[model samples]
Target chain A: MESVGLVPVLCVSVVLFVTGVAGVLTRKNALIVFMSVELMLNAVNLSFVAFARQNGEADGMIYAVFVMAVAAAEAAVGLAMVILLFRNRVTVKLDDLDIMKG
Target chain B: MPTFNDLWLASPALLLFFGAMAIMLGEAIVRPASKTGFWALALGTLAGSAALTVVIFLGPSADAFGGMLRVDQFGLFAQLVCTLAALLTVLFSDDYLRALNLRVGEYYSLVLFGVCGMGLMCLANDLMMVFVALEVMSISMYVLCALKRGDPRSVEAGFKYFILGAFSSGLMLYGISFLYGATGTTSLPGIGGFFMGQHQGTQATLVAIGGALLIVGFGFKVASVPFHMWAPDVYQGAPISVTSLMSAGVKAASFAAFARFVYGVIGTHSAGFVGVLWWMAAATMVVGNLGALAQRDLKRMLAYSSIAHAGYLLMALVAASTGNASNNPALASLLFYLLAYTFMNAGAFIVLAAFTRDGQDYTDIDSLAGLGKRHPWLAAGLSLCLLSMAGIPPTMGFVGKFYLFSAAIQSGQVPLAMIGALSAAAGVYYYLRPMVWMYMKEGHTEARVAPVAFTALAICGFALLAFGLVPGPMLGLAQTSLQSLIPYTIPTH
Candidate 1:
């Protein structure tokens, strides 16, 4: 792993991403889904910071800062929305949103 | 040193940012329900920013912020369109929101914020800037969609929109990562350089993959086919005004920005871009038109129609890539279609708002039955709108379609042009269906307000006819706007 350079690190990020995607996809609970989304974002953040270090450019770090800001905002809105959803459906089931079915 | 060139570069954004602050202040001073002041300030603010954009346009095009944003004719035209749409939205929003008991002070403020984000997005020459500006726009719009909190549909629309929108943003950002991986920079010109400098086959392949991912990201935003699943439900459930905003304002802004990204950077083979977009555009046209056929709900029908129009614009994008952009005039066609679409789509929604009198919105096609007898002027206005949407002659939609088809034929994409015209003919059925209900079917449909901002309605109607019959000037305007965008040379690092 020490011999592995930035490319392998990018691969690790990709692995984390796939795991997160799996979590979001296989889970039924909204909480789990939200956590998976965070996981995905964190993976991206790690990859970005790695790319920043590897490329020797500051844009990746700037982008990481943006990712954090956006992640924080997304969390706030997502949680608020989750609470509202729970209030409406009385259950946190993702499958319950059938009001829009054709 | 902060040069004057940089100051001039930032003027449009500076104008809108300060405009938003001014509106908030005016709201503070005038207080709630001060319709006149809120609207005047809103109009004054957008008009000011638009004027700033025009001023910026007259000067030479250049990049700013270490090559993150670029101010040019393309950005200027999009900013103008978005600001104008926001202004018109504010013009009638007071009455509409007042009627619905949703006229919060923040609505105008959010609208301005959304417009500002949209304007910034139009000028975003960098990847990270695009994401930030897009979020600002999306978050505000999510709030706006659910602003009518009392309505279950409104809340539903907002939640659905938020979830999908957030997901799409992530996907887009993820795509940008792949792009950055390939290019080593997020700037458009930088990416262009990565492509131009790299003679390596694998590097070109990497860029293509990134390009494809980026297309997926944009596909979700623009509600293209396969990415359009959310549009009908969301458009139907959201507020009428929000629907209007999404259909016209958001569509135009996103398309302009997307065009800049694809055309200005990502210098792929014309055929490759055209082929991918061709399949996407054709699919969108078919699916959207087909979906609209089965929808009984007016909002849902228009939603699908919105998807179909997105397809038409995508066709223009494809045409732009192909030889047609030069030979057949695809850019002008696309711009003209966007303008005509703004009028007809928004006019129809205004009529829908007029009918949202007795607690719930009038969603069903049956709801508009005998509207002609009940509300003659509203019916007439809506009829004109529908006809234009159907691409019938002597209406703006027809002229727009003529430009589109002529351009397509000129570009040697005869099949695409044919499909567009045929599907548009199918459009006549749904567009005219409401008219048939209004004229032939028997029912009472009274608008609560007798006056109902008939002036704007009249303006919309007249604009369609005036532009349709005498499209020369508007065509020229569109051509000039397109020309201003033509000199965009992707900078090589």
Candidate 2:
């Protein structure tokens, strides 16, 4: 535990965030994309915690908590939207959800 | 601990919050026979909120909840615009909702909730508050966009918005985290102080990256080019009423926050950012105007127009960053233009909403043919709105564009202003195309002009012309409203 520093944690957070972004960009499944968004948010939370520890302030940790709460609310809403899409079109594929275009 | 003063200062947001809760509860309990009661409640709540915002705007600037919220004239003015946008949206929504077979009490509550979020976003002084308020606004909009769940287009629009909006929020949060690492605080003024005080090393890099990410987040929200793919789709898919509120209210709130963030954090230290914003402004203007010319659907065309308007407003931010706070008129121009946009954009959408027939929206440009003959009053009102959007003289949009471009030139951004002017010139052709269809072409159609919606459109068109003719008082108000932000922008000299 003592060996881990802010830089290493931030590196790990960056990796997680990049992976999440890749999942969102490459994946066609809506639910998987939703989960990727959550991963990105969690990565943000990790960075915030590490930064708070480095700064010796409680603000970043509290912000991480706020992020968690917001992410939860977002998850509830995102899942509901996905379900609505499924019910309306019987598929949650991003490619299939193209009833509107130029 | 929060005192009574804090609660009073935050009353506008609290009013909308309680109003939304009451409507939601009323929906579950009474399940009212008509949506009139909910509509009235929403209107009264927005009116009360607007009134409170005006009162605060007139009073001295103050902060609430230990500076998490700033009740300054700038914030109050933005809140007033947002509340007005929500009010006008509700005014035309009841009849349109019934016309489209979307009779639900939740619509009013969600709009109120969304306005509540918008109000908070305008006043938010802390990054955490901004994030929470943004989500509150976006989540409500996501639900509102999908309100017509039976329509696959509507559902798909909501889903796409959710995906992209969430992605941007995540990026913004990560940026905030990096900024916290650099400065050890999330307060705008604190971050400003950190930058102004000599700083060096990896912190500068962090600040640069964080600021870029923040711009990306806001760019997505305001629907600037390169991040604007979802806007036309969402606007064309969602109910017209929702699209109106989204364009006017959401854009106003986001710009308000963006202005504060840029001024507070970067201020005169925006040497690197001005070039980025310059290219963005030029590209957005050309793309949005060119896109609109190709669109045959009125809704999609307006969506593109809204994107172009965002580019114009972004030019104002660029100008503000180039000059000192006391001399710059960019922020004031941004505020004034946002107000003008709210009226004209909302009025145009209400006109579109009025044209629904046989349970479908007639959004095709051809559907407007011969409207000048059959419905002269409605046609005239829409023409006023459209002409204002095209920046013709004696309209508020023209006044706004003049102030914005003059500010850019004053800041030595001549090429940017020229690009804006040329794109705006290109925009006029499409803005007039609809009028040609309305008056010059021949067809027969009857538009159901609800009295409430007509009254709202009349108010909007009247405000545009009246203010355009006498823009002195309103422009003065916009100029004075920006004074409060100066304290947060520490001098880099």
Candidate 3:
């Protein structure tokens, strides 16, 4: 059985993280931005697992699990906020959230 | 398997967690007509937790939960500050909630849960603990900000905060993973020990990048410049009570974890991030203070003021990098200033909470017009709070600023100290503008003060004055708290 090298896994993780960041910055739809955040978290999980394997320890893997759980909790609240925003303002686009601008 | 000793060590947070759960259960089962019982329970829980934190503060330092948390005087001090902030916030929340017609038992439970997370954050000894605790605190805050669901502005604030908050947490998590790979451990002291050993090439690069990312993540949480765009809008939109707690309690807890991480993980090798922090502190102060000058809304102005205070706190971290660990005036000043900030900042918001009409907070600067003539004592309390914020003499803010700047000068951060002083001086204009309206302007505002909230404000005003006049005992305590971090604080060359 062949295993991936640490450098390659890290590179892929970085690329995925960059993409997620771009999505968060460029995407206007609140739902997409949130999904992008999840993507970033998953990218982190991949790196954590890879690092744990390279280090021959379970700490990073444990951290990955924790990140997943926390992300789910965040999603639950984030989606509720989105729904709440829609209920009040009838829009989910980030641009529409301009009620309290300076 | 955890021992009884571990439970005892962590009981302050555990108590809040259980209290929050009890509130939820009791609210559901009893469905009481009045929320006073629930409010009293929450306040009692916070007071009890604060008392326990003080007892723990008097005890010796130790680690609990297998070194997941350090039970030290430093963390205990932060926990005490957080509990106090939460207590005052709850004391004032009932009236504000009633004024706005927000009837949900969850408000008390969420506040308790949030404070529980803050206590855990102060004591967190591991990177993983910091991340988890941060989310726990932030999620509660997200809901609280939008508790006024009928208001579009409140919902927008909550959504914006959620998106940005979640984004920053992801960035922080990625940084933590890099750090874990670099040091092969999630423990703060373990990372410091790794740096103490030989490290070169790829490992060094990993640490540098990881540390930078971590700072950026913290920058957003504390609402410093470039990352602070969300602050004014969210602060303006959220319910005033939530804003007060978020500004005080969240900032204190986040700064606690940030200070511990900087002193513990990046100890002695402050060169890695000190330069970055220097610029951040400078920009945050200048931008925050200047930004406040243009604001017509009082809430927005205070939000910017809070950002400027974050800058001052970051200056202390910069100084910490230059001096010996145990004797570092920077760390001591940071602790004292956080306590002072929690009081004055929250006290200011309590006064703003008094301006409710038709289920909305009237936070325009004009809303304060003629307050001095109409409500003399309320205006006096607010004036004291504002003076303290402006660094006026015989107030806690003055004493705190003096310590912070002197510590910076002592660490040879003279230029940064000057920038802080100049910006704080500029800040005085906005702080005084409200007073001018309260006393000199002729517009009318029928503000009503709640007894409990007024008492809390009085306590804040008295503490600001008393501590400003006799700061010796408090300064001594702040300095002694640093002793517990000796093992983690490596002496600089």
Candidate 4:
């Protein structure tokens, strides 16, 4: 409470997280869903930065970098899989593919 | 002997890595469709890894990379079991894959990667190492489960596994954060020591919540009760070969970490933690056996059976409760049971693998009909396996169950022990139903396509029988493994 300027940073990060979660929940497009995941990562990054500033520790910054690395790796694999999925099924509409029901 | 610590800890990984490379390279040297050579080399690697693990058992437990990784008797024994599991699985896969016309060179490679992951998990002492190793194991397994991509069910299994696995990982990471926040460190004993100091503080609330969430993550991995919804679908869809590996190799490695986490890290601080775990263990036992009872599909039945066994293991874990400095019979029972459990479960899956033939997998209880008449040996092997799983006398499973219950009783956890015993007794009905189908059915069914590979794994099942009857060496091994918790008490053991 005493280190007063952190409120705006926390609020923005929380908003970013909510928006990302909403986009992932509502979006039907695969690309947009992926974008939402990315958005969530960015929100995490923002929070990490804010925490880094507040805690005056370098760990949060290092964690943000690691998260970015993981995101990149995930993107590479996810995009490859998406391409494979599209090739297997003619269309990419998320709802159109119902071939394998649990 | 290289002081027992030189490079033996990582030799298993190295052997598999080199073996994979050698196999892939050997593909060009061999005639097309010559599957025997690839598997031989793969087995050679696993055997070498197993031997290395034995050598590592001698002495000089080393903490590689400043204790992030510990190579001790506990990890060594776990890796040995994992390697042996992979080896047995490959034996079964040889015939099964051929039957499905799905024999590919990548099978050995994927199996290697899975073993690699399991070994890393066994070795990991740090939280980050555990996560990384888990991902490595899981990613390899995801691909392996859907190796038969032509089958829609296989692909679905892969997707479901990946999604749920990632979800669990995220939950685990979140839990780890709270643990870190509460303890101010990620080292297992550091957290343990931290909890020791702050057993009754403001952090108590966070610690309980975090510990419970962590349990949820682990519960999923072990396929215990509530998080068990995935096992049946995934097990049924996966090629029988992969399922064998998943049931054996994956289970052993997961339990290794489970013991370390519960016994070493969190158990030291609070009674409430162990109390929560006790209920989780109880729920897992009851739900698992009941779920298995309704399954007609052999794979699905075994899947649920696996959950029940996981519950049994949880009993060992419950008995093993480490926070107090009491002599825990539970941990000892867990050790014996895991050894027994591995042999019986892996053997049963082998019989299932044996029955997979001519581009079709036989999984229905009816498929096993007249098996005794059709193929006496295969029927006998499978019957032994099932009987063992049902906790019948003179089998490894019985000893395991007996040890577990006796431990619970000795510990004064009698009601818990009784529940496990009753649930196990109920388990005998479904387990015996398979036997009746294999024996009493009148119709003629085709004999399983007898394969030498499957024969070897069936031999593993018989080995369990021998161990069960005598149990001297195996019990000695288990006790030795249990005794060598040197890494836990001394970081530089």
Please give the range of 10 consecutive residues that has the lowest summed lDDT in model 1 chain B.
B484-493
Query: How far off is residue B354 in model 4, in Å?
Result: 2.2
Could you tell me the TM-score of candidate 4? 0.88
Ranked candidates (lDDT, high to low)? 2, 3, 1, 4
Q: What root-mean-square deviation over C-alphas does model 4 reach?
A: 4.1
Q: Which stretches of candidate 4 lie over 4 Å from their true place?
A: A1-102, B1-6, B21-33, B199-206, B322-326, B486-493
CA lDDT of each prediction against the hidden true structure = 0.78, 0.90, 0.90, 0.73
Better of 1 and 3 by TM-score: 3
In model 4, pairs of residues that clash are B267-B323
lDDT of candidate 2 at residue A19, scale 0 to 100? 95
For model 2, residues B194-281, the per-residue Cα lDDT tens digits are 7777767899888888878888888899998788999999998889999999999999999999889877677677677767877888
Expressed as tens digits, the lDDT of each residue in B353-464 for candidate 3 is 9998568789999999999999988899889999999999999999999999999999899999999999999999999999999999997788988889999998998899
Clash total of candidate 1: 0
* Model 4 lDDT per residue over B1-493, tens place: 3434435567777778788777766665654586877877788889988887787777667777656677777777888888888887887677678888986887787788779889878877876567667867877787788777667667656655654565565556545544655555456666666665636564676577667767887888988878887888888878888888898888888888888888776664567777877887788889888888988988889888888899889877777773234556667667677767677777788777766767888788888888898788878878888888998888887887877888877766777888888888899999999999989997566555446666665676777788779877776777677665532333321
Which interface RMSD does candidate 2 score?
Answer: 0.7
TM-score of each: 0.93, 0.98, 0.98, 0.88
lDDT of 2 at B205: 86
Candidate 1 wrongly placed segments (more than 4 Å): A1-4, A22-26, B1-9, B22-37, B197-202, B267-273, B324-328, B449-452, B487-491
Q: After superposition, which runs of candidate 3 have C-alpha atoms over 4 Å from their true positions?
A: B487-493
In CAPRI terms, model 3 is classed as high
Per-candidate DockQ values are: 0.47, 0.92, 0.90, 0.23
